[model samples]
Target: MYLSDKVLIVEGKTDKRRIEEVLVEPVQIICTFGTMGVSKLDEILEQLDGSEIYILSDADKEGRKIRKWFKKHLSESTHIYIDPKFGEVGRCPRDYLANLLMRHGFYVDTSLIMKGKFYDERAVGDTGYIQSYSL
Candidate 1:
């Protein structure tokens, strides 16, 4: 669920799919494919469209390398990281990841907790992952 309004630069397809699955709306995710080549970066820049870019990468060595590259090239972007205490994004629990996202005001795409409404209200505290109440 890549948002057309903003661009999310991630490490790979798995991260893209996972983020998309939990998002309430589509997001624009750019996959590095594993350390994107300098030659390919021009294309990504073209697609950026002046929107805010968010960098969410794994905590491992390669992830850091990729982050560094993006920071150097795309200096004016926000970098989001999962708390290492939980785990890497790929293996992290979905709800946990959702909470991490929610901390930043992003909400999950929800279904049928009520007849017409989607999410009810703001979830309380740091762990604000969505909760379903069957109607």
Candidate 2:
């Protein structure tokens, strides 16, 4: 129910903002800005008091790279990846992300769009959010 101890780590401001908009609990979000600098990430991780960490990045190659990076450095932290299946319908990380949360039983607002709305012709374009990442 309450995600007071669970933190969602993303890759940028837009991802963080979009995720916060849909979550019911107070989920702390951290952005790595393409590649998370070791010192910066270390500082952020140090501040965390053993909270569960969920990594939600774009369902693309770059996202996998970032996830891999985190896995190597934060192996002890509980980590879960946003499902890539949702990305097939809508490339916006938010769409797949919202669905991922829904699958995990997290309450997310779907009033503006219903289930499977991602398959709508209007929602077919890619967000290009993953292109900016180098990995």
Candidate 3:
């Protein structure tokens, strides 16, 4: 596959699949499977140089571990957090992911931007979408 300037690091295939549904631009998404290890890091490092990296994992213990590992090795990478309520990236509402990605300057499918029942209406600002539940 062609390499993309932007790379998204996710926890598993399910998470990768969810993000793929809304992506409008080319982004290489890599799955960590679960907890990160030296071997996995070695594989991921090859594609990281000169690319914009975005770390997005679940809101759970294993996810935090992976995030911490990435932070230590890839401090320059941007971290994208999903609200604890969503639990897992794969489980997060599509609209929520769409808005979050948009705020991060990533192109997403506009059709996935409709309001979700869990969104706080008050948070909708000039962007015309939920600001973000992510940190």
Candidate 4:
């Protein structure tokens, strides 16, 4: 199973959205939010059908617990942790998962889509350029 053909399993909708936003290629994203149990794990694994898998979750204690449980169940899947830096407001997870994957040699960056916003407050502070004032 190749990484490109694999599916990424996340913890919630926000994680799914963020992963989609950062990934260079289109891959399936699965969410397992609020459904943490043995049955749910079995169901998800069955749906995966032994395909290559990557697990990206928060870098907190809860995330660690989830990872442990997933590892115990889906021992064959490839799991990776997305650092907390990718999270939004320290609550909603961000798209840093994709970036971390790219850092590894498994995934490739195709379209090079750059999501998120960039602010340039310096433009507003350029008094000389705006007011035509010379030093």
- Models 1 onward score TM values of 0.74, 0.64, 0.83, 0.64
Candidate 4 lDDT, 1-135, residue by residue in tens: 333567777778876776665555556777778357888887787778656787766766667777788888777777775546644212432333433555442332323313433212232235522111111
Clash pairs for candidate 2: none
lDDT of 3 by residue, 98-134 (tens): 8787767677776677765433454467987644322
Candidate 3 Cα misplacement greater than 4 A, ranges: 1-3, 115-135
Model 1, which residues run further than 4 Å from truth? 1-3, 85-87, 110-135
- In model 4, the Cα lDDT at residue 5 comes to 62
Q: Give the TM-score of candidate 3.
A: 0.83
Kindly give the stretch of ten consecutive residues in candidate 2 with the minimal lDDT sum.
Answer: 126-135
The Cα error of candidate 1 at residue 5, in Å, is 1.2
For model 1, how does the per-residue alpha-carbon lDDT over 1-135 read when each residue is reduced to its tens digit? 333577888888888888876666456888887686787678788988888888888888878887888889989988889767544566656666665565555555443222222223455435664453232
Q: In model 1, what is the error at residue 46, expressed in angstroms?
A: 1.2
lDDT of each: 0.69, 0.61, 0.83, 0.57
Name model 2 segments beyond 4 Å from true: 1-3, 78-96, 110-113, 117-135
Candidate 2 versus truth, CA RMSD in Å, comes to 10.8
The TM-score that candidate 4 achieves is 0.64
Pick out the ten consecutive residues of candidate 3 with the lowest summed lDDT. 115-124
Clashes of each: 9, 0, 0, 1
* Clash pairs detected, candidate 1: 1-20, 1-26, 1-27, 2-26, 2-27, 2-28, 3-26, 3-27, 3-28
